[model samples]
Target: MATDQELELIHDPAYVNAVRLAGKGKLPKEKAGNFGIGTEDTPIFPGMHEASALLVGGTLQAVDYVMTGKSQHALNLGGGLHHGFRGKASGFCIYNDSSVAIKYLQEKYHARVLYVDTDAHHGDGVQWSFYDDPEVCTLSIHETGRYLFPGTGNINERGQGKGYGYSFNIPVDAFTEDDSWLESYTTAFTEIVEFFKPDVILTQNGADSHYFDPLTHLSATMRIYREIPRLAHKLAHQYCEGRWVAVGGGGYDIWRVVPRAWSMLWMEMSSNPTPTGPLSPEWLDTWQPDSPVTLPQSWDDPEGIYEPIPRRPEITEKNTLTVEKLLYPIRSNQSSSVKPT
Candidate 1:
């Protein structure tokens, strides 16, 4: 578990104390809102601090494995609480593990980090934490905040001062299908890594963008999940010399979408051939009894699982435009630096 001091690397000391008190049921009810506790999204429960800190510790451990050369890659499926703030918690995230781990990477390893967040919601806390620091670059591709919670991550909210142009946000429109989603993610991630040339790559792999997820409106399938890790794995080797750490983020469809998505992630990370047949009967039998919905029989989502979207073309066009605009400055800078002799 992470020590209190370690958590304070990204969280405020007073706010960390508040979470501890709230976890033990010692916090005053009136003061709970000051720290964003006792809310519907992040209600205080017994051992909340320990639970949150344990996730942070998991991400830190992943960082250690990669930076120390014990492993080329590490994953903490419980980490990636990106909505956590320095002084508050939002969107059911108590402690921001990605933020804390990035800080740890910089302080301990002195690594220039590139953070890529693919959760359906914006990675607001992690972005804001390093918004003014040029050494850390944050890129988030999420459902447009116009209809989502913590409505931020617009293209205009680039970094500030010396960090300007380092923060990239591609807020794709709602109901975006697999093709558009992958286009945005693939293009932005590839270009950003080339520009930043980071020492290490940290990815927040939230599986909530699938059509089955209740919280988000995107219509991505298992195809995107398969490819997301494939690109991250490739780029880790190509750019960061195989230094990659991945963490979980927002996936509300735990029964069907999350398991398959995360399993594919691990398979790709470990260099296993992608499985294409029915899921294991033993695995299905273990969890099917408690699931309210029928679990998927296959590893990939069935074709036409959802109704055909009428706005598919428009949505794709808009998403393409957004990515183009977000990358315009970087592309411009790259072009201008070329010698024409």
Candidate 2:
């Protein structure tokens, strides 16, 4: 677990104290409410501080492994609590591990960090944490928050001041399918990496965008998950010399989708072959009995996983517009022969 001092790298001291008190059930309900604890999203549970700190520590460990050349890439499935704020917890995240890890990277290694969040929700806290800092660039692609929680991540919500044009958000429409999602993701990621040339790439690989995920509205299948890691691994090697740290976020379907998506990520990172056809029967035999829903036998979701969306064309057009707008600033600079900072 991370030390309290380490958490202060991103979170406020006062907020840390409040969280500690609430975790031990010492803080009164009224007082905890001020810190955004005990609500439906961020409940005041025992050992909250320790649990949250452990999550942060896992990301820190990944950062250390990659930065120290002990590993080319590291994946922390417990990290990527991106909605946690400096002084407030939101969206069920008590601490923002990704923010703390990025700050740690900056302070310890003096590296330029590129944070890519692919969760179905906007990585609001991490974006805001480094919103005004040029050293850290955060790119998030998620379903539009107009009908989602946190209500942010608009295409025009670029960074401010010196950090302007660094924070990139591509909020696709609801019910967006695999092809459109990957198109936006691959295009933006390729362009941004070339523009920033970050020393290290930190990816928030949230699997909640799948159609089976209860928390999100996207219709993406397992194809995106397999392809997501492939691109990230390739780009990390190309731009950052293989320095990549991945963290998990907002995958609500822990049984079926999260396991498969996260396994594909690890497989890609470790240079193992992507499993196809049926999953290991041994693994299925162990987890299937406990799973509330039937687990898929194949590596990828079956064809026609969901009933066809009625507004597929409209959603695709709108998402394409958002991507174009998001890339306009970069494209404009290139066209005018102006270099990005």
Candidate 3:
């Protein structure tokens, strides 16, 4: 569905040619000089195009299932390579799977989609790609890009052209704990649900923000990480009539964190009431020598060294402030609606 639109989003014809070349079992080994396929993060692997096609295909599957009403919600815990641009494959991303899916949703389903990103890194590529079209409301809640990689999610980077205020970037204070993290999500997302009024919701839920993740510095815990997927499911039912798609973003702690956290997300997509059961010994056995840490029977892991889910004021403040700031603009222009998809 998105192959043609993806070529446009990935502006460079050369990169598009490369994608085609890779698809046909002909990838250049010298490197995709400026195409972002040869960088340290996204090295020029042999089947780079094929692997990317799989990711894009996974996201497209979610789009197809949701648009056709076969599934009210879909979550692909292996997609969401947000940093990749139309041409460049930065950050281990060959193709912008989320963008391709969004383009497909807009074209095929004719649905107004709201993309909610909760990864620690700013979703700069996705936001920039649709920075001018108000039909897609791209909202991101991340640690200030100032302190992070590809840093650029400032609050003022709202939208341009028809999309002026539709793009919302909620970069939070650094070194936050579970309370701060949970509050931030609930706060900003609630108002977004009210205003965007999307026909469907697509989310990039990166697990790297977890305290156990090695790539990021934010201190969100497993309890909070687990809640994000749950909340995405809830939001789908609440506003978008249960049309939702959630994809995995950046998470490097493959053994200790990614598997457990993503399991919670898959369970959410399947509407599992209690995903508290022990990890399958069968699954755990597969991880033995490569992953030294045995998969936890239970997915729950506390965030702080001591403090768990606290009813403290600092956390409350974080959540409240995030919601309030996001609403500040919407309130000023109550009549302004996101351009219809």
Best by lDDT: 1
- Residue-level lDDT tens digits of model 3 in 137-192: 99988887766887888878889989998999877766667767777788678878
Candidate 1 lDDT by residue in tens digits, 131-185 = 9999999999999999998899999989999989889999999999999999999
lDDT of the structure predicted as candidate 1: 0.95
Clashes of 3: 1
Worst 10 residues of 2 by lDDT: 332-341
Rank list by lDDT? 1, 2, 3
Clashes of each: 0, 0, 1
Off by over 4 Å in 1: none
Return the lDDT, model 2, position 175: 95
Q: CA lDDT of 48 in candidate 2?
A: 95
Cα RMSD of all models vs. native, in order, equals 0.7, 1.8, 4.3
Query: Which tens-of-lDDT digit does each residue in 1-341 have in candidate 2?
Result: 98888899989898899999988989888888888889998899988999999999999999999999999999999998999999999999988999999999999999999999999999999999999999999999999998998889998889999999899999999999999999999999999998889999999998999999998899999999999999999999999999999999999999889999999999999999877889999999999999999999989999988999999999888888888889988888877886555
Candidate maximizing TM-score:
1
Q: Work out the TM-score per prediction.
A: 0.99, 0.98, 0.87
